[model samples]
Target: MSFVTDHILKNPPVLLGLIAMIGLIVQRKTFAEVVKGSLTAVFGMVALTAGVNMLTGTIAPINTAVQTQLGVQVADGLSDVTFTAEYGGTVGLAMFLD
Candidate 1:
C-alpha cells in the first residue's frame, strides 16, 4: 500500500534495519554469538556499577556526620550563614566576625 511505502520512506533507518534483519533471518544468521557477547558486556558493566555504588555509600555517612556535628551545611565552601551591616561602620570579614 501507498501508506506503508510512505511510512517506510519517512523513517529510513527503521526501514533499512527491518529489511536487514529480515534478510539475515532468511539467510539463517544464528543469534547465539550476539547474545553471548551482549551478556558478557552487561556483566562487566554491572561490576563497575556496583563498585561505584559502594564508593558513594562509604562517603555519604561521613558527610552527614560533619553537617550534623558542625550545625552548618557544607556545600562547595558556602556554609548556611547570614550577615547584617551598619552603614559607614567597620568593614570586611573582621566586621562580619564581630
Candidate 2:
C-alpha cells in the first residue's frame, strides 16, 4: 500500500494518466480510447519533464559563468537545487487539481 501510494499514486505522470483515464471513462469512452488518452497524458508528462531538464541543464552552466564573472555567490544550501527536485510534487498536485 505504501509502495502504491508513494510510487504510483504520488507520481505526477501516473496521476495525470489516471486523471485522463478517469475522465475518458466518465465520458463513456471505449477501453481503447481510454487507454490511448491515458498513455498520451503520461507520455506528454514525460516529454515535459525531459524538456525542463534539458532547459535547466542548458541554463545552469551559463548561470554559473555569469555568477563567476560578476563575483556573485549562491546562497548557502541552495547551490544544488533543481526545479524538479524542488517543486515536482507541488507541480503534480496542481496539475491533478486542475
Candidate 3:
C-alpha cells in the first residue's frame, strides 16, 4: 500500500533490514536467524544515525566557540549562523569527492 511504500520503503534502516531478511531467507536460514539478522541490520543503521547526530551536535558548540574567538561576522540580513549553514557546501563537496 501507499503507507508501506512511503514509510517502510523510504526508511533506510527498515529497507536494509528487509534486504537482510531476504538474503537470509535465500540462504535457507532458520526463522530465528533471519529475524536476528534483520534486527541487527536495523539496529546498526540506527546506531550509525545516532552517532552522526551526536557528532554534529558536539561540533556545533565548538564551531560557535571558534567563530566567537575569531570574531567572525554574520552576513547582512542573517539573524543567526550555524556550523552547517556556513560549511555545508564545502563539506558536501568533500564528501562527494571522497
Best candidate (score: lDDT)? 2
| Ranking of all candidate structures by their TM-score, best first | 2, 3, 1
Model 3 clashing residue pairs (backbone):
none
When 2 and 3 are scored with lDDT, the better candidate is 2
Better of 1 and 2 by lDDT: 2
TM-score of each: 0.38, 0.71, 0.61
Clashes of each: 0, 0, 0
Ranking by lDDT: 2, 3, 1
TM-score of 3: 0.61
Displacement of the residue 69 alpha carbon in candidate 3, Å:
8.0
The deviation in Å at residue 40 for candidate 2 is 0.4
lDDT of 3: 0.73
lDDT of 2 by residue, 1-94 (tens): 4454556655778988988998999999999999999999999999998898899999989999999999998775553245545565566556
- Comparing 1 and 3 on lDDT, the stronger one: 3
lDDT of 1 by residue, 28-96 (tens): 767864444445555655676578778878987998998899898765634211221221122222322
Q: In model 2, which residue pairs have backbone atoms overlapping below 3 Å?
A: none
Candidates 2 and 3 compared: the better one by TM-score is 2
RMSD of each: 22.3, 3.6, 8.6
Ten consecutive residues with minimal summed lDDT in candidate 2? 77-86
Q: Assess each prediction's global lDDT (C-alpha) against the native.
A: 0.49, 0.79, 0.73
Candidate 3 ranges beyond 4 A from true positions: 63-98
